[model samples]
Target: MKPSAFEYHRPTTPEEAAELLAEFGDDAKVIAGGQSLMPMLNFRLAVFEHLIDIGRLTDLTGINHDSGSVAIGAITNQATVGRSALIRTSVPLLSRATPLIGHFPIRNRGTLGGSVAHADAAAEYPAVALTLDAEIETLSSAGRRTLPAAEFFIGMWTTALRDDEILTKVTFPIREGRSGFSIAEFSRRKGDFAMAGACVAVKVDNDLRVESCSIGLFGLGSMPIRATSAERSLVGCSIDELQVRDVAHAAVSGLESVPADLHGSAAYRVRVGATMVARALKSALEEATDD
Candidate 1:
């Protein structure tokens, strides 16, 4: 099925695009890369009378890294991210998660903003953002405002972005000291969405004990979930004394609203999610200790 007829609006500037959305209100939608939105539109799952295409805004297309943070322009494609030395060195967790996002061809056209804004339960970028406490920056008539990843994602396929707001960039704070990151997931095929997955970032002390840890789960909940309790449990624990399976279990133990579908029962998803967390946590710990 084709999308319903709609006005095609190509706004050269983000401010102009935000204005279009502000004017069109509920009838308008912002589109960049269009990988996710186009599929929904083709399926008639979402319909809008106006498409505010900010694909060429230029203002949102690069990677910037400072000592403390890494800011990726919203329109930067996943392929660029994968090849980015800055991203790999400064935000290694993001780099590791990049290849896991669909296939190379999809990554070529899928914008970072599109993936995050679309907020798919199984997407890698959102999980990475949540794990890193990244800040999402937006532009609107009200001017600029930054929303932390924790507050940016509200529910499945929804965000805190206002009608007039255009996401311009996402900034991730660097993890200092000895850090390691890993992501683990189970998918039906190489390019298919994960049935369950976890992204782990860990910082260890010189004694090889956990100083801090962040685990972000995807494909098992309504929104990207931060396994905060599990993180707290691992603090100060030596790698040799840590039981990865137990921590993984704790991560999923408190989870509610995990989705159940033909892919798996809610129980099955929980099991898979826990296993992913275990695998990711183990790999991250190994990396941290090696460093």
Candidate 2:
């Protein structure tokens, strides 16, 4: 099957893209890397009347780091992001998770914004973004605005972005002092969507006390889930294996709402969630201590 016939518009500027979206409304769709969207189009899952391609907009193409945050352009490819030294050093959680996304070829063509905006429940970027409380900046006909990562992911294949809005950048805060990051996932093979996964980020003080912690889960929910209760457990605790395990356990204790798919049952996914959380947190804690 092929996508329904649609008008194609390649916008050179975000303003132009926004205007096109405003004009076409729900009938319009944006194309970035075409990694996820193309498949949906090929299957006739998305029937759009217009495709506004923003792939060439120079504005949406780079990684920038500052004292307080790291900002990545919406069209930045996963391969570029995965290999970025700034992302690795400043937002190590993303670095730990990126390699787990599909494979090298997919990464080269898949954009960070596409993955996060598409909001696949099993994707890596969403977990890192949500866990770090990253800010998603958007341009719309109304104006530019920033959406909190927590508010951005409303459900599977859904987001807070309106039809006229295009995500321009994703920004994650840079932690000071000793920080830890970890990600764990299960797949039938190296490049498959995870059956279950977890990401853990910890910031620690000189006294080995946790300053802040964020844990995000995927492949066990409708959207990337930030484990608030689990994160709270790590605050003020000394970063250690026992503490990490306790928090990991707390992370999945009440998660009885996961979907049952062919990959696994709800009970099995919950179990995987707990185990992955423990592994990720333990590794993150170790990394924090070493730093």
Candidate 3:
């Protein structure tokens, strides 16, 4: 199916894009790589009167690192972020999770900000952002504001971004001391969305006890739900297989309401969720020790 008729505008600057969005209001849809939006358009799930293409906006296309965090431009492609040496060193979790998004071709065209803006519950980057407590920067004619990951994702295919607001950048805090990060997904195939998945970030103190940690799960809830119970379970515990599995089980307590789509039964998703969480935790622990 083809998308309905819409006026197309390619804005050279974010301000211009914002102006177009403001003019079109809810009838306008901002597209970057067109990886996600195009699919929705083709399916007729999204209808817009004005299509604003912002991929060519040079202002929104770079990766920068600061003393405390790394900020990636909204239009930065997945492959670029995945292959960046700075990103690899600053936030290894992103480097590790980008490939799990789709495939080489998709990664080449998919933009990080676009993915976050689209806010697919099962997407890897959103879970990573939640796990790392990343911040999303939004721009509008009014001004700009930064939103924490937890507040950014409102629901499935929905975000805190307003109609006139454009997500401009995503920033993640640099892991300070020894850290471990890993992702595990239950995809039917390499490029498919996960039936269930988990991303874990762990910081260990010199004593080898978990200083701080976060676990984000997809295919478990309406949005990427934080495994708070699991995080609490690991706070003082030494990293080990049994401990990880136990915490993973604890994480499933409040997620009993997961949707049962064509991917799998809710029960099967619970099982996969448990397994992915455990695997991600163990992998994160191993990486922490190696570091």
Candidate 4:
């Protein structure tokens, strides 16, 4: 299916994009890599009178690290981000999760910011962002503001971004001290959306006890599930098989809603989600010990 007729504008600067969005308001949609938006447009899932293309904005296309955090430009492609040595070194959880997002070609055209803005519950970036306590930066004619990942995703395909605002970048805090990260998911196919997934980041003390941990679950609810219960379960304990199982159970214990679809039932998804969380936590623990 072909997209409906619309006015297209290519903005070279974020200011120009902000102005275009402000002028068009809800009638405008921002297009970066076009990986997610193009499909929505083709299928008529989303329609807009003005298509604002910010893919050419050079300012929003690099990865930079400062202190203990890394800021990734919104327009940076997933392929680039997945392969970035800087990201692998600074934010390994993101590096581990990016490859799980579709295939190489899709990653080539998918933008990190686009994924975060799209806020697909089954996608990898949103969960990773929540796990790392990432900050989302947005711009508008009214100026700029930053939001925590938890506040950014309000619901499925919904975000706190206003109609006239554009997400410019995401800043992720790097894990300090001895840390390890892992992501696990269950999907029908290699590039398919995960039926259930988990992202885990763990920081350990010199004695190898779990100091701090972050667990993010996807494909189990309206939005990415931050497994705070599971995180708390492991904070002062040694990361072993028994502890991992306890953490996994805690991760899904309070999920009030589980999506029921042709793919699986709510019970099935919760079970799979728990397993994925256990696997991720175990992997993260192994890596932490190695470090």
Q: How do the predictions measure up, each by TM-score?
A: 0.98, 0.96, 0.97, 0.97
1 against 4, candidate with superior TM-score: 1
- C-alpha positional error of residue 8 in candidate 4 after TM-score superposition, expressed in Å: 0.6
- Clashing pairs for predicted structure model 4, backbone only: none
lDDT by residue (1-291, candidate 2, tens digit) is 888898999998989999999999989999999999999999998889999999999899999986699999999999999899998888888887888988898999999999999999988899889999999999999999999999999987789998789999999999768888889988778989888899888878888888888889998889999889878777887654245566777898887459787778999888888899989888888888894
Off by over 4 Å in 3: 240-242
Q: After superposition, how far is residue 260 of candidate 4 from its true place, in Å?
A: 1.3
The 10-residue segment with the lowest total lDDT in model 2? 238-247
Candidate 1, run of 10 with poorest lDDT? 282-291
Q: What is the C-alpha RMSD of each candidate to the true structure, in Å?
A: 0.9, 1.3, 1.3, 1.1
Q: What do the candidate models score in CA lDDT, each in turn?
A: 0.92, 0.88, 0.89, 0.92
lDDT value, candidate 4, whole model: 0.92
The TM-score obtained by model 1 is 0.98
lDDT score at residue 98, model 2, on the 0-100 scale: 84
lDDT-best of 1 and 2: 1
What are the per-residue Cα lDDT tens digits for candidate 3 across 1-291? 999999999988899898888888999999989999898899999899999999988899999988899999999999999999998888989889998989999999999999999888889999999999999999998989999999999887889999999999999999978899999998898898888999999988787889898999997878888988778767877654237677888887668568797768888899899999989989988888884
Cα-based lDDT at residue 59, candidate 1: 91
lDDT of 4 by residue, 56-104 (tens): 8999989999888999999999999998999999999999899899999
Model 2 alpha-carbon miss at residue 206, Å = 2.4
* Angstrom error at residue 132, model 4: 0.3
